[model samples]
Target: MEYGNPDFVKYAEAYGAFGHRVESAEGLAPLLEHGIKTPGVHVIDCPVDYSENDRILNQAFLRAFGSRRQAMQKVLFKPATGHGPDA
Candidate 1:
């Protein structure tokens, strides 16, 4: 029920104000309301599960969006070097 990043709330809201898409897990639904479809973000109702360690990383999360937006719906995770941060 509590977000790890307190700043995310204010930051997300600010982005919403600027017409930037906003989405979150089901729990965050309480935070983003009143403007479900008014040029705003889409709050996904999926929980983050690191259980997919063999698949996702922090950067994977960032890349997925751009990939989806730029015609590459498939978010390839290259944890080797060609992708994500130097983790």
Candidate 2:
């Protein structure tokens, strides 16, 4: 299911915190630096495109391991007892 994209900057500001909106990739570094150096709760609303997440992560996993299935097998933990929620 999809959710509404709320104005995170305004939300942060409403809670009496520092809010910064990154307009471009160049602005991200400066905003990050400012947020870290400054005091109080700081929120940086950096828009990210997650469309290529699966492809990128899968490629990285393939490079690290031999294949995506191998990576999943290594990372995913399976309970031997089978006494958990799913059981």
- Candidate 1 has a TM-score of 0.21
Q: List the residue pairs that clash in candidate 1.
A: 21-41, 22-41, 22-42, 23-42, 23-43, 24-43, 24-44
Error of 1 at 46 (Å): 5.7
By TM-score, the best candidate is 2
Clashes of each: 7, 0
Task: Quote the RMSD, in angstroms, for model 2.
Answer: 5.5
- How well does candidate 1 score on lDDT at residue 61? 52
Q: What digit string (tens of lDDT, one per residue) describes model 2 on residues 1-87? A: 978678999999999998789989999898888888888999888888888998998889999989878888877854366677877
Give candidate 2 regions above 4 Å deviation: 1-3, 54-87
Which residue window of length 10 is worst by lDDT in model 2? 75-84
Question: What local lDDT does model 2 show for residue 68?
Answer: 75
Native-vs-model 1 lDDT? 0.48
True-vs-predicted CA distance for residue 78, candidate 2, Å: 14
- Give the whole-model CA lDDT for all candidates, comma-separated: 0.48, 0.87
Error of 2 at 44 (Å): 0.6
